[model samples]
Target chain A: MIHPLAVSHDFGVWVGALLTLMVFSFLYRDNPFYKFAEHVFVGVSAAYWMVIGFWTTLWPRVIVPLIPEASRIVSSDTPLPERDLSAVVPAVLGLMMLSRLVPRLSGLARWPTAFVLGTTAGYAVVRYVRSDFMHQIQATIGDGVLIPAAGGGWNVAESLAALVTLSGTIFGLIYFMNTRRGGTVTTPAARIGLLVLMVTFGASFGSAVMARISLLVGRLQELLGDWLGLL
Target chain B: MKRPTPQILLTGVALILVVAAFMAPPGDGSSGGFAGAVTYADRHFSSWFGILAVFAFLLGGASLLRTHGRRVRERKADWHYSAVTLVSFLAVLIVGFLKLGGPPGLTGDPTDASSWLTTIFDSVLSPLHATLYSLLAFYVASASYRAFRARSLETSVLLGAALIVLLGRIPVGVTLFRFDSLSLWLLKVPNTAGQRALMIGVALGVVALAVRMVLGLERGRGGDGS
Candidate 1:
């Protein structure tokens, strides 16, 4: 007996490492392996999401509501929840969203589309105004450019930083507001604003790059340390 | 003008929500009549959105099958890829739904201890996603190298800021230069300032768009143009 293909051999570790290699093969140039992996990724990921949605959402909200008996699947000993007829509204709307497949009733799809859009827009406006506009401004400069010291005196360094923050914010707004394209409508505020915005975007992108670097490091660690048994 | 059902619904739904926003100032659970009703409606609408998302996923699955199935049947270029996609999709979907290898039960757990779907996810999906995302490191580095040429004052500031931020994240920068605090200051002060400005602008734009949608001025969004 070969001891079931050796005690140390693990199936999943090998498959994961190979899949990682297949995807990385694109760095060498596009090829069949990369394409195959890409397709598999797409298919598997979509199916995985669907599975999650079924388990997390549809199974509970739709199935359990429609067939209260389905709740027993969650646990054999738990009480069955009350049957709710309201679940049918969402069910119908959901089907309506997919009516685009048919030629004649394709227009029926608009109902759900409109419903989602309306609700989202309404929801978003309130959130954006409250959080983004009102709260952000209040935190940024609503108390004036005075960073009060713990003992009630002005902390010069903190106050300077606060002033810079206020000025940068106002100038950045100036740049965005002054969207005219020409030879030179560039006000001093806009010029300063442009610099601030660039710095901001650069810092943001740098954070993203660092994130990717961490992921790369992690993937490499997995390949070398876990799969190859080398740290 | 011809088809009006979706338009009417869009107007009505948006009006209700916007009206609720004005009339039912949040934390008004104590205020008994209309405000309470509006709050309840708002909660229901959010729930409805979530419920629709689940169905939308199923719809997306159907769309994927139709698109790929056609390509495979028509013997389109690289139809084998489509075949692979279809096989993988069906295998995962079926195995997950059937709860294959799970404890003799109807619980729809895709990651059941002995499940094939879980095996596929652990061995296949996780690595693929991590590897794909990690590939961005090369792309981002190369793109930054090209873009950070410092042709003007703005680009120079961008280049400097990026380098400072990047160096701040590395052990050498922290050890030799004490660049970490400088980078943190840059992120905290100026970054916050710019982001807040942008957020305010975006909030205003959203309010405008929302109002347009409510008034049915944004009819093009409804694909039927109703």
Candidate 2:
């Protein structure tokens, strides 16, 4: 920590400190300062992303491929499009996406939209089935009811703990799938499942708190150490 | 689904993809065969999808400009804020696109360390974004306060687990409560079980949704009512 009198005179650091304070002002309530900061953030972040997207995706995937001559401006090192004609497909679809800007031709955008959603649905169906459904179920209950002991014999206590876990997993599954139906599956197991879910959510909240607190601490450290020179 | 052409396209594309993904011999399809062709198609589709996704940023920028421009023109509420937004947006775009204060060319990296865009991002955008996320810390605390006020068995369980986990993480709390072991057990056993169950359930939902989309019975997000 340095003295407040010794705070750095850098213009960027000052700007950062002021923006930090402006955002923190939201904690007091809505105000013009907060609003201004929020708007600036929105605009700047959006433009930052657009500039990034143009440089990364558009310039390489579409521009360089479609117009090989344009590569001179993109940088000397950018590989001349490996797959030449294939770039035309996405380029056309992307242009079709912008057709929505015109009121009459807005329906033309649906073709690209359909492609995006269709491809996503295709991947999602296969991915979730293999990863989330089959793999998760296997991980949850793959352990046999009779547990192996560290020594030589079957361990009763460990087996019972395994049983508890297996039962909790089943109960939780039942709760999620059969809650709205309100049938025989909504037995005492569902209540247990509810408790398990609650515990899970609480643990998740605690984890999220840790993450946010770390960020908060980092910002505070920056303000104190870098800006105010009073760490 | 209600629209015939898009619905068919959606169904057909999804069906072909699902079939190719499942049936095409796995392992990145590197060797020369039908499998390689299928894998190549799938990979190209994904790359195209990424390119298509970037176009959404264009739509976002256009939407922002239109909304803010309309508000400023009509002098609506908070019009000055809209004006500020437009100025900042255009300023960043212009400076970055022009490659200001760096290599002067269309291909020059606008976000290079030496560029003015990098300067604005470092001092302005970065702080605002991080501080925005930091606000969530305060929000989480306030939310937990309200939630804990609910006197019930469930809240009791939630509070108990949260307290243990929170205490287990910090140095002083761990020394005082010895909650580290219990927290580990809670996370490893019960949390894992619950998460697995949730995952399975959500997977089932996703599959169902996918099936609906593939069958043209549903067009939820990109449907746009048509």
Indicate the residue-level lDDT of B124 in model 2. 95
Model 1, span A120-206: residue lDDT tens? 877888899899899988987777888788998998888888888898888888988775866243688888888888889889888
How does model 1 score by TM-score?
A: 0.92
Q: What TM-score did chain B of candidate 2 earn?
A: 0.86
Give the DockQ-based CAPRI class for model 2.
medium
Looking at model 1 chain B, which ten-residue stretch has the lowest summed lDDT?
B217-226
Which residue pairs show backbone clashes in model 2? none
Over the stretch B10-39, how does candidate 1's per-residue lDDT look in tens digits?
776777777787786676345668777677
Model 2 chain A, poorest ten-residue lDDT window?
A: A177-186
Q: Each model: TM-score of chain B?
A: 0.87, 0.86
Score residue B102 of candidate 2 by CA lDDT: 72
